[model samples]
Target: MKKSQDDAKSLQERALRLLARREYSYAELMQRLSRFASKDVVEEVLDHLSEAGYQSDQRFAEVWIRNRLQQYQGEQRIRYELRQKGIARERVDQEILAANPNWPELAAALYRRKYGEMLAPSREEQAKRMRSLLNAGFSYDQVREALKHLDSEAEFD
Candidate 1:
């Protein structure tokens, strides 16, 4: 019993130190703490942090989404990344919708930045640019809207 108590305290301290540096989702905290303690102990520590309002998956998701958006990443990539971090699909969708970004416009700006104000003269060139945007996590609609004005010099703005 004493051993378990000491382990819990140690895990708590380690968790606190990590949280001090940055917010962590419950899943992330558990993965980190599980390396040093049992699953039960890690869960208990995480529960304690949750109760104390030290760790929050929602907050982590929000911050992570914001950071990724600032990096001009697409919604698909952001959703995938949040899911990989153990955030729920519902929560990911909720946060993304709340951000209210203009996907088509963002896609246009990204394409313009990468390929410049030049139009793809050949079918092969157009296909290559389309492939690049699609691979960058843009939806078909967004990609289409982005390339719709490929000949317009002021399309990027």
Candidate 2:
């Protein structure tokens, strides 16, 4: 019995170590830890980590949103991903807008990255670019605002 308890403790510690290296949402932690610990043990360790302030979904969401947006120009795609990661919807929204994302800027940057330039020389090209932006998870308004004399050469960072 004592050996079993010690093993559980060890697993928990290893889980925390992995988490400390980088942020992990609750669901992410479970997915990663399940390999080393039983479902019940994983849950127990998660609960302990939560109570001890070592794990916080709110913080995870906030950091994830900030990092992804800055690194990837993530918009709705990242928002949905965070929800899937078990972050509360409200918290995800709060974190996403915490830095007040420049929607037009992000859209322009993403558009430029996916397409060569905002103003296509031909209507067909413009339409194709528009479709690409939409598929990249940008809203119509965002695409319009971004493409309205948008320049990708301007660095967002």
Candidate 3:
């Protein structure tokens, strides 16, 4: 019993260390700590932390969304990332819809950063780039709109 208790404490401490470095969704923390704990202990510690105000899904979601936006990742990418972290799809969508990120502006900024002062690629090239952008988490319409502006002028003020 003592060994079990110590192990649980250690997992909590390690989870805290990780959280201090960066916000993590409750599910994410559990997944990471579960390597060191049983499923039941992981759930108990998570519940304790949550009740003590040390863990929060909404706060985690907010910070995750903010970081992704800063990195120019669109809602599609952010949602996918959150799901991969074990956050519910509904929660991810709720946060993304609430965010309503400016994909057009973000895509434009990313395009400019990567390919400044160069002509937009040919339609075939642009299509490939578009696919890459989509894979990077942008929507089809957002890519089209951003590329339209980019193709219009190699040098945008």
Top candidate by TM-score:
1
10 residues in a row with least lDDT, candidate 1: 148-157
Across residues 29-74, which tens digit of lDDT does each residue of candidate 2 receive? Answer: 8988888768988888889998988999988987887777665444
RMSD of candidates 1 onward, in order:
2.2, 4.0, 2.4
Candidate 3, residues 31-51, lDDT tens digits: the string is 888888899999988888889
* Candidate 3 runs further than 4 Å off: 1-3, 117-121, 151-157
lDDT of each: 0.85, 0.78, 0.81
Show where candidate 2 strays beyond 4 Å. 113-118, 149-157
The RMSD (Cα, Å) of candidate 2 is 4.0
Which pairs, if any, clash in model 1? none
The best-first sequence of candidates by lDDT reads 1, 3, 2
Would you give me the overall lDDT of model 1? 0.85
Candidate 3, clashing residue pairs?
Answer: none
Kindly give the number of clashing pairs for every candidate.
Answer: 0, 0, 0
